[model samples]
Target chain A: MTVAAQSEVQVDNAEVRVTEWRLPPGAATGPHRHGMDYVIVPVADGEMTIVAPDGARAKAQLKTGKSYFRKAGVEHDVLNETATEIVFLEVELKV
Target chain B: MTVAAQSEVQVDNAEVRVTEWRLPPGAATGPHRHGMDYVIVPVADGEMTIVAPDGARAKAQLKTGKSYFRKAGVEHDVLNETATEIVFLEVELKV
Candidate 1:
Protein backbone atom coordinates (compact mmCIF):
# COMPACT_ATOMS: atom_id res chain seq x y z
CA MET A 1 0.00 0.00 0.00
CA THR A 2 1.26 3.49 -0.81
CA VAL A 3 1.95 5.55 2.27
CA ALA A 4 0.15 8.76 1.41
CA ALA A 5 -0.30 9.66 5.04
CA GLN A 6 2.27 11.45 7.21
CA SER A 7 2.48 12.30 10.89
CA GLU A 8 4.74 14.61 12.85
CA VAL A 9 5.20 14.50 16.59
CA GLN A 10 4.86 18.04 17.85
CA VAL A 11 5.11 17.13 21.51
CA ASP A 12 6.36 14.04 23.34
CA ASN A 13 6.48 13.80 27.09
CA ALA A 14 5.92 11.33 29.89
CA GLU A 15 2.28 12.26 30.21
CA VAL A 16 1.10 12.78 26.68
CA ARG A 17 2.12 12.93 23.00
CA VAL A 18 0.80 15.28 20.34
CA THR A 19 0.95 14.29 16.71
CA GLU A 20 -0.10 16.19 13.60
CA TRP A 21 -1.50 13.92 10.92
CA ARG A 22 -1.68 14.84 7.25
CA LEU A 23 -3.23 12.73 4.56
CA PRO A 24 -3.71 13.28 0.89
CA PRO A 25 -6.66 12.06 -1.08
CA GLY A 26 -7.12 8.31 -0.83
CA ALA A 27 -4.62 8.00 2.03
CA ALA A 28 -5.11 5.94 5.16
CA THR A 29 -3.65 5.32 8.61
CA GLY A 30 -4.13 1.56 8.30
CA PRO A 31 -5.69 -0.66 10.92
CA HIS A 32 -4.41 -0.10 14.44
CA ARG A 33 -5.45 -0.38 18.04
CA HIS A 34 -5.17 2.49 20.45
CA GLY A 35 -3.13 1.89 23.59
CA MET A 36 -4.03 5.18 25.23
CA ASP A 37 -7.07 7.40 25.31
CA TYR A 38 -6.81 10.13 22.72
CA VAL A 39 -8.48 13.19 21.22
CA ILE A 40 -8.67 14.35 17.63
CA VAL A 41 -8.98 17.95 16.44
CA PRO A 42 -9.70 18.36 12.79
CA VAL A 43 -7.66 21.12 11.20
CA ALA A 44 -9.45 21.05 7.88
CA ASP A 45 -12.97 20.23 6.80
CA GLY A 46 -13.30 16.86 5.06
CA GLU A 47 -14.76 13.39 5.31
CA MET A 48 -13.13 10.16 6.45
CA THR A 49 -13.99 6.49 6.10
CA ILE A 50 -13.45 4.50 9.26
CA VAL A 51 -13.00 0.74 9.04
CA ALA A 52 -13.66 -0.90 12.36
CA PRO A 53 -12.02 -4.02 13.74
CA ASP A 54 -15.10 -6.12 13.01
CA GLY A 55 -15.08 -4.96 9.39
CA ALA A 56 -17.71 -2.30 10.01
CA ARG A 57 -17.38 0.79 7.86
CA ALA A 58 -18.59 4.28 8.64
CA LYS A 59 -18.20 7.82 7.42
CA ALA A 60 -16.96 10.54 9.74
CA GLN A 61 -17.74 14.06 8.64
CA LEU A 62 -14.95 16.35 9.69
CA LYS A 63 -15.82 19.79 10.95
CA THR A 64 -13.29 22.40 11.83
CA GLY A 65 -13.32 23.68 15.42
CA LYS A 66 -14.72 20.44 16.77
CA SER A 67 -12.93 17.60 18.54
CA TYR A 68 -13.65 13.98 19.47
CA PHE A 69 -12.24 11.60 22.05
CA ARG A 70 -12.22 7.86 22.56
CA LYS A 71 -10.86 5.40 25.07
CA ALA A 72 -7.93 3.10 24.53
CA GLY A 73 -8.20 -0.33 22.81
CA VAL A 74 -10.36 1.05 20.00
CA GLU A 75 -9.30 -0.44 16.68
CA HIS A 76 -9.88 1.11 13.29
CA ASP A 77 -8.48 2.30 9.99
CA VAL A 78 -8.98 5.95 8.97
CA LEU A 79 -9.03 6.81 5.30
CA ASN A 80 -9.41 10.16 3.61
CA GLU A 81 -12.54 10.29 1.44
CA THR A 82 -12.30 13.77 0.00
CA ALA A 83 -10.48 15.11 -3.01
CA THR A 84 -8.41 17.50 -0.94
CA GLU A 85 -5.87 16.95 1.77
CA ILE A 86 -7.01 16.05 5.26
CA VAL A 87 -5.25 17.24 8.41
CA PHE A 88 -5.86 16.85 12.12
CA LEU A 89 -4.18 17.00 15.49
CA GLU A 90 -3.99 13.87 17.64
CA VAL A 91 -3.23 14.02 21.34
CA GLU A 92 -2.65 10.79 23.22
CA LEU A 93 -2.57 10.73 26.97
CA LYS A 94 -0.20 8.34 28.70
CA VAL A 95 -0.74 8.02 32.38
CA MET B 1 -13.78 42.13 33.95
CA THR B 2 -16.45 40.41 31.91
CA VAL B 3 -16.21 36.64 31.85
CA ALA B 4 -16.27 36.37 28.09
CA ALA B 5 -14.27 33.21 28.14
CA GLN B 6 -15.69 29.72 28.55
CA SER B 7 -14.22 26.23 28.62
CA GLU B 8 -15.81 22.80 28.31
CA VAL B 9 -14.16 19.51 29.17
CA GLN B 10 -14.56 17.32 26.16
CA VAL B 11 -12.70 14.38 27.61
CA ASP B 12 -11.49 13.62 31.11
CA ASN B 13 -9.85 10.37 32.08
CA ALA B 14 -7.01 8.97 34.14
CA GLU B 15 -4.39 9.72 31.51
CA VAL B 16 -5.51 12.89 29.79
CA ARG B 17 -7.99 15.74 29.78
CA VAL B 18 -9.26 17.65 26.77
CA THR B 19 -10.84 21.10 27.02
CA GLU B 20 -12.27 23.41 24.45
CA TRP B 21 -11.81 27.09 25.23
CA ARG B 22 -13.62 30.01 23.71
CA LEU B 23 -12.80 33.66 24.28
CA PRO B 24 -14.41 36.79 22.96
CA PRO B 25 -12.76 40.09 22.23
CA GLY B 26 -10.78 41.38 25.22
CA ALA B 27 -11.38 38.15 27.09
CA ALA B 28 -8.70 36.49 29.17
CA THR B 29 -7.91 33.22 30.85
CA GLY B 30 -6.47 35.18 33.77
CA PRO B 31 -3.07 34.65 35.36
CA HIS B 32 -2.51 30.95 35.81
CA ARG B 33 0.12 28.24 35.89
CA HIS B 34 -0.16 24.95 34.07
CA GLY B 35 -0.08 21.89 36.31
CA MET B 36 0.33 19.45 33.42
CA ASP B 37 1.96 19.51 30.03
CA TYR B 38 -0.50 20.50 27.34
CA VAL B 39 -1.01 21.16 23.68
CA ILE B 40 -3.07 23.94 22.07
CA VAL B 41 -4.69 23.79 18.67
CA PRO B 42 -6.16 27.07 17.53
CA VAL B 43 -9.50 26.78 15.78
CA ALA B 44 -9.92 30.40 14.76
CA ASP B 45 -7.34 32.91 13.61
CA GLY B 46 -6.74 35.73 16.06
CA GLU B 47 -4.05 37.48 18.06
CA MET B 48 -3.52 37.07 21.77
CA THR B 49 -1.60 38.96 24.42
CA ILE B 50 0.33 36.89 26.90
CA VAL B 51 1.25 38.46 30.22
CA ALA B 52 3.99 36.76 32.15
CA PRO B 53 4.35 36.56 35.91
CA ASP B 54 7.09 39.13 36.01
CA GLY B 55 4.96 41.64 34.12
CA ALA B 56 6.42 40.66 30.79
CA ARG B 57 4.04 40.85 27.89
CA ALA B 58 4.06 39.45 24.35
CA LYS B 59 1.78 39.08 21.38
CA ALA B 60 0.91 35.67 19.93
CA GLN B 61 -0.41 35.61 16.40
CA LEU B 62 -2.70 32.69 15.90
CA LYS B 63 -2.57 30.74 12.69
CA THR B 64 -5.15 28.20 11.70
CA GLY B 65 -4.11 24.54 11.33
CA LYS B 66 -1.07 25.04 13.57
CA SER B 67 -0.60 23.67 17.06
CA TYR B 68 1.73 24.31 20.00
CA PHE B 69 2.77 22.53 23.19
CA ARG B 70 4.32 23.55 26.50
CA LYS B 71 5.48 21.81 29.63
CA ALA B 72 3.94 22.21 33.05
CA GLY B 73 4.58 25.10 35.48
CA VAL B 74 4.27 27.72 32.76
CA GLU B 75 2.52 30.82 34.10
CA HIS B 76 0.82 33.46 32.01
CA ASP B 77 -2.35 35.42 31.34
CA VAL B 78 -3.89 34.98 27.91
CA LEU B 79 -5.90 37.85 26.44
CA ASN B 80 -7.72 38.02 23.14
CA GLU B 81 -6.80 41.06 21.06
CA THR B 82 -8.90 40.64 17.98
CA ALA B 83 -12.45 41.74 17.31
CA THR B 84 -13.79 38.21 16.81
CA GLU B 85 -14.04 35.22 19.06
CA ILE B 86 -11.02 33.03 19.69
CA VAL B 87 -11.36 29.29 20.11
CA PHE B 88 -8.78 26.57 20.75
CA LEU B 89 -8.51 22.96 21.80
CA GLU B 90 -6.34 22.10 24.80
CA VAL B 91 -5.16 18.59 25.68
CA GLU B 92 -3.60 18.09 29.07
CA LEU B 93 -1.58 15.10 30.18
CA LYS B 94 -2.37 13.83 33.67
CA VAL B 95 0.66 11.66 34.24
Candidate 2:
Protein backbone atom coordinates (compact mmCIF):
# COMPACT_ATOMS: atom_id res chain seq x y z
CA MET A 1 0.00 0.00 0.00
CA THR A 2 1.06 3.58 -0.60
CA VAL A 3 2.24 5.50 2.43
CA ALA A 4 -0.16 8.13 3.71
CA ALA A 5 1.48 10.40 6.27
CA GLN A 6 4.85 11.83 7.14
CA SER A 7 6.13 12.33 10.66
CA GLU A 8 9.00 14.62 11.53
CA VAL A 9 10.71 14.26 14.85
CA GLN A 10 10.43 17.57 16.62
CA VAL A 11 12.11 16.56 19.84
CA ASP A 12 13.64 13.43 21.33
CA ASN A 13 14.78 13.45 24.89
CA ALA A 14 15.28 10.96 27.66
CA GLU A 15 11.69 11.52 28.75
CA VAL A 16 9.68 11.64 25.56
CA ARG A 17 9.54 11.86 21.78
CA VAL A 18 7.57 14.53 19.98
CA THR A 19 6.64 13.97 16.35
CA GLU A 20 4.83 16.30 13.99
CA TRP A 21 2.71 14.24 11.61
CA ARG A 22 1.25 15.45 8.34
CA LEU A 23 -1.27 13.29 6.51
CA PRO A 24 -2.79 14.11 3.19
CA PRO A 25 -6.03 12.62 1.92
CA GLY A 26 -5.92 8.83 1.78
CA ALA A 27 -2.63 8.82 3.61
CA ALA A 28 -2.00 6.53 6.55
CA THR A 29 0.39 5.90 9.38
CA GLY A 30 0.52 2.27 8.27
CA PRO A 31 0.17 -0.61 10.68
CA HIS A 32 1.93 -0.22 13.96
CA ARG A 33 1.73 -0.89 17.65
CA HIS A 34 2.39 1.62 20.35
CA GLY A 35 5.61 0.73 22.12
CA MET A 36 4.88 3.17 24.91
CA ASP A 37 2.17 5.45 26.17
CA TYR A 38 1.33 8.31 23.83
CA VAL A 39 -0.65 11.53 23.52
CA ILE A 40 -1.99 13.06 20.33
CA VAL A 41 -2.81 16.70 19.68
CA PRO A 42 -4.62 17.39 16.45
CA VAL A 43 -3.41 20.45 14.57
CA ALA A 44 -6.39 20.56 12.20
CA ASP A 45 -10.00 19.45 12.31
CA GLY A 46 -10.69 16.36 10.26
CA GLU A 47 -11.86 12.74 10.29
CA MET A 48 -9.78 9.57 10.42
CA THR A 49 -10.26 5.88 9.91
CA ILE A 50 -8.67 3.44 12.27
CA VAL A 51 -7.97 -0.10 11.15
CA ALA A 52 -7.19 -2.27 14.06
CA PRO A 53 -4.90 -5.24 14.22
CA ASP A 54 -7.81 -7.59 14.85
CA GLY A 55 -9.56 -6.34 11.73
CA ALA A 56 -11.79 -3.97 13.67
CA ARG A 57 -12.46 -0.55 12.24
CA ALA A 58 -13.52 2.79 13.68
CA LYS A 59 -13.75 6.45 12.89
CA ALA A 60 -12.19 9.20 14.93
CA GLN A 61 -12.98 12.87 14.84
CA LEU A 62 -9.98 15.15 15.02
CA LYS A 63 -10.71 18.48 16.62
CA THR A 64 -8.07 21.16 16.59
CA GLY A 65 -6.67 22.03 20.03
CA LYS A 66 -8.17 18.95 21.65
CA SER A 67 -6.00 16.07 22.71
CA TYR A 68 -6.20 12.38 23.60
CA PHE A 69 -4.03 9.73 25.20
CA ARG A 70 -3.74 5.95 25.27
CA LYS A 71 -1.56 3.32 26.81
CA ALA A 72 0.96 1.21 24.97
CA GLY A 73 0.25 -2.09 23.15
CA VAL A 74 -2.58 -0.72 21.02
CA GLU A 75 -2.19 -1.62 17.36
CA HIS A 76 -3.84 0.13 14.46
CA ASP A 77 -3.43 1.90 11.16
CA VAL A 78 -4.53 5.51 11.02
CA LEU A 79 -5.83 6.88 7.76
CA ASN A 80 -6.91 10.33 6.72
CA GLU A 81 -10.55 10.50 5.62
CA THR A 82 -10.87 14.14 4.71
CA ALA A 83 -9.96 15.82 1.44
CA THR A 84 -7.59 18.33 2.95
CA GLU A 85 -4.45 17.64 4.90
CA ILE A 86 -4.42 16.64 8.54
CA VAL A 87 -1.69 17.37 11.05
CA PHE A 88 -0.99 16.18 14.57
CA LEU A 89 1.54 16.53 17.32
CA GLU A 90 2.24 13.11 18.81
CA VAL A 91 4.16 12.80 22.04
CA GLU A 92 5.39 9.36 23.01
CA LEU A 93 6.53 8.75 26.54
CA LYS A 94 9.88 6.99 26.60
CA VAL A 95 10.62 6.89 30.29
CA MET B 1 -1.07 37.42 41.43
CA THR B 2 -4.14 36.28 39.53
CA VAL B 3 -3.91 33.40 37.12
CA ALA B 4 -3.80 34.19 33.41
CA ALA B 5 -4.86 30.81 32.07
CA GLN B 6 -6.91 27.71 32.86
CA SER B 7 -5.97 24.07 32.38
CA GLU B 8 -8.35 21.18 32.03
CA VAL B 9 -7.02 17.68 32.40
CA GLN B 10 -7.82 15.88 29.21
CA VAL B 11 -6.14 12.59 29.97
CA ASP B 12 -4.14 11.13 32.82
CA ASN B 13 -2.72 7.66 32.61
CA ALA B 14 0.10 5.63 34.03
CA GLU B 15 2.51 7.14 31.57
CA VAL B 16 1.43 10.69 30.95
CA ARG B 17 -0.83 13.60 31.89
CA VAL B 18 -2.44 15.62 29.16
CA THR B 19 -3.74 19.09 29.96
CA GLU B 20 -5.62 21.48 27.77
CA TRP B 21 -4.43 24.96 28.60
CA ARG B 22 -6.29 28.17 27.82
CA LEU B 23 -4.71 31.54 28.39
CA PRO B 24 -6.42 34.87 27.94
CA PRO B 25 -4.69 38.21 27.62
CA GLY B 26 -2.56 38.85 30.70
CA ALA B 27 -3.29 35.40 32.03
CA ALA B 28 -0.57 33.25 33.51
CA THR B 29 0.02 29.64 34.54
CA GLY B 30 1.66 30.84 37.71
CA PRO B 31 5.13 29.91 38.91
CA HIS B 32 5.91 26.24 39.11
CA ARG B 33 8.49 23.58 38.41
CA HIS B 34 7.86 20.82 35.94
CA GLY B 35 8.05 17.65 37.96
CA MET B 36 8.19 15.66 34.75
CA ASP B 37 9.19 16.15 31.15
CA TYR B 38 6.54 17.78 28.99
CA VAL B 39 5.55 18.63 25.44
CA ILE B 40 3.47 21.59 24.30
CA VAL B 41 1.38 22.01 21.17
CA PRO B 42 0.17 25.50 20.41
CA VAL B 43 -3.43 25.88 19.29
CA ALA B 44 -3.25 29.48 18.18
CA ASP B 45 -0.74 32.05 17.00
CA GLY B 46 0.29 34.36 19.84
CA GLU B 47 3.14 35.67 21.96
CA MET B 48 3.93 34.87 25.57
CA THR B 49 6.26 35.88 28.35
CA ILE B 50 8.14 33.42 30.48
CA VAL B 51 9.04 34.48 33.99
CA ALA B 52 11.79 32.31 35.34
CA PRO B 53 12.21 31.20 38.90
CA ASP B 54 15.16 33.52 39.40
CA GLY B 55 13.18 36.57 38.26
CA ALA B 56 14.57 36.18 34.75
CA ARG B 57 12.17 36.66 31.83
CA ALA B 58 11.93 35.90 28.15
CA LYS B 59 9.52 36.24 25.26
CA ALA B 60 8.16 33.33 23.20
CA GLN B 61 6.22 33.31 19.99
CA LEU B 62 3.55 30.66 19.70
CA LYS B 63 2.65 29.56 16.23
CA THR B 64 -0.44 27.50 15.63
CA GLY B 65 0.28 23.80 15.01
CA LYS B 66 3.85 24.04 16.22
CA SER B 67 5.06 21.97 19.15
CA TYR B 68 7.89 22.10 21.67
CA PHE B 69 9.29 20.03 24.49
CA ARG B 70 11.44 20.34 27.61
CA LYS B 71 12.92 18.18 30.30
CA ALA B 72 11.86 18.01 33.93
CA GLY B 73 12.91 20.45 36.66
CA VAL B 74 12.35 23.54 34.53
CA GLU B 75 10.75 26.36 36.47
CA HIS B 76 8.85 29.19 34.85
CA ASP B 77 5.60 31.10 34.83
CA VAL B 78 3.90 31.20 31.44
CA LEU B 79 1.93 34.35 30.67
CA ASN B 80 -0.01 35.40 27.62
CA GLU B 81 1.11 38.68 26.07
CA THR B 82 -1.41 39.11 23.28
CA ALA B 83 -4.92 40.55 23.46
CA THR B 84 -6.43 37.28 22.27
CA GLU B 85 -6.64 33.91 23.91
CA ILE B 86 -3.93 31.29 23.55
CA VAL B 87 -4.50 27.59 23.87
CA PHE B 88 -2.13 24.62 24.13
CA LEU B 89 -2.13 20.89 24.56
CA GLU B 90 0.40 19.94 27.17
CA VAL B 91 1.49 16.35 27.72
CA GLU B 92 3.57 15.59 30.76
CA LEU B 93 5.33 12.28 31.04
CA LYS B 94 4.88 10.62 34.39
CA VAL B 95 6.65 7.38 33.92
Write candidate 1's Cα lDDT for B40-74 as tens digits. 89988888889999989999987776778798999
TM-score of chain A of each: 0.93, 0.93
Best by TM-score: 2
Off by over 4 Å in 1: A1-3, B1-3
User: What local lDDT does model 1 show for residue B84?
Assistant: 81
lDDT of each: 0.85, 0.85
Angstrom error at residue B49, model 2: 0.6
How well does candidate 2 match the true structure in TM-score terms? 0.91
DockQ for candidate 2, please give it.
0.78
Structural RMSD, model 2: 1.9
lDDT minimum window of 10 residues, candidate 1 chain A:
A10-19
- Per model, kept true contacts as a fraction are 0.57, 0.82
Where does model 2 exceed 4 Å of error? A1-3, B1-3
Candidate 2 per-residue lDDT, tens place, A1-95, comes to 55559989988877778898999987999999999878889999988899998879899999997888887898999988779788888888887
* Model 2: residue B61 alpha-carbon error in angstroms: 1.1
DockQ of 1: 0.60
